[model samples]
Target: MRVLHGLEEIFAAKGSLLGTSDWVTVDQARIDAFAGATGDHQWIHVDPERAAAGPFGATIAHGYLTLSLLPMFMVAVYRVEGARMAVNYGLNKVRFVTPVRVGSRLRGSTELVDAQPLDGATAQLVFRTTVEIEGAERPACVAETVSRQYFGD
Candidate 1:
């Protein structure tokens, strides 16, 4: 994991591939819980039997659910120091390249795409994230996540 002492240091360094997270298996229970929490109980994501007969031959996870794992994956990559707080600014771009099937192992790779000064003691960082499914040719999710980190006074 690369450590950035300050925002200026981060901006000076060229983009580096942070690291990958341990594979997290996507199961039916997890999908169901995400569906319940988000009130997005779509048939393709929640109905196992029906989904088996449908498109992907099995129930798949919601793209948003996969997108939401960015923070968790980041934890496995690096830690930001000298910051009083960090906020999720927004996503610049997001794409669901492939479906994540039940019981599939998934992990993410992060690269520091951009680091720019936002305001006094704050910097905006854009991380290019790729969520990969084990044994799959295409990634499950691809996104550019933006974050704002504020330094302590």
Candidate 2:
């Protein structure tokens, strides 16, 4: 994991790869749990048996479910040590390029796209995050995620 010492380091690292996260398996239990949590029990995501006859031939993870894993991926990727707190600002663009099937191992590659200093000793950072699926030609998802970090912690 890459640790940026302060806001300066974070800003200086713009347009560079922050880090890649370890693989996380997308399994039935997790898919089911996500469905229960979000009430998104689509057959393609939560019903393995039914999904076997549908496209992809197996249950798959929801696009939002894959999108939600960004924070987990970021934890493994990098951190700003001097930041007192960091909050997710919002997402700019998100694309589900490919489906994430059950049992597939997924990881994230995050890049520091830009950083803007804000009032109150904070900086808004933009990240280009790609969710990669094991052995897949295309990534599961690509998103532009923003974060606000309070420095001088």
Candidate 3:
């Protein structure tokens, strides 16, 4: 994992690849739970048997489900020690490059795109992140994320 000592370290490291996270599998149970939570019960995402004859050869995860893993993935990428609190600002862009089939292992590759000082104790950080599907040529999702980090006084 990449460790930044402070918010300035994050700003200084802009334009560099921060870190890659460990792989996490997108399994049936997880997908089912996401479906239950989001009310996205698409057959391709929740019905393995029917999906086998449809597309991707298996039940695949919803794009949003993959997108929602950013927090978990980003945590593994880096840490700003003095920044005791952080909030997801929003996404600048997001694309689902490919499907994430059930049981596929996924990981995140994160790069620090920009860092803007917000105030004496806060900074706005932007990350260019790609969610890679194991053994696939294309990523499952690509996103630009913005976050606000607040440093301790």
| lDDT to native, each model | 0.90, 0.93, 0.93
Residues 30-149 of candidate 2 have per-residue lDDT tens digits of: 999999999998889987889999989999999999999999998998988878899989999999999999999999999999999997599999999999999999999999999999
> Total clashes, candidate 1?
0
List TM-scores for all candidates, in order.
Answer: 0.95, 0.97, 0.96
The clash numbers for all candidates, in the given order, read 0, 0, 0
Better of 1 and 2 by lDDT: 2
Model 2 spans > 4 angstroms off:
none
Q: Name the lDDT value of residue 83 in candidate 2.
A: 81
Where's the lowest-lDDT run of ten residues in candidate 3?
3-12
Model 3 clash tally, residue pairs: 0
Per-model root-mean-square deviation over C-alphas: 1.1, 1.0, 1.0
**lDDT (0-100) at residue 50 of candidate 1?**
97
Compared with the true structure, the alpha-carbon lDDT of candidate 2 equals 0.93
Which runs in model 1 stand beyond 4 Å of their true positions? none
- Model 2 alpha-carbon miss at residue 120, Å: 5.7
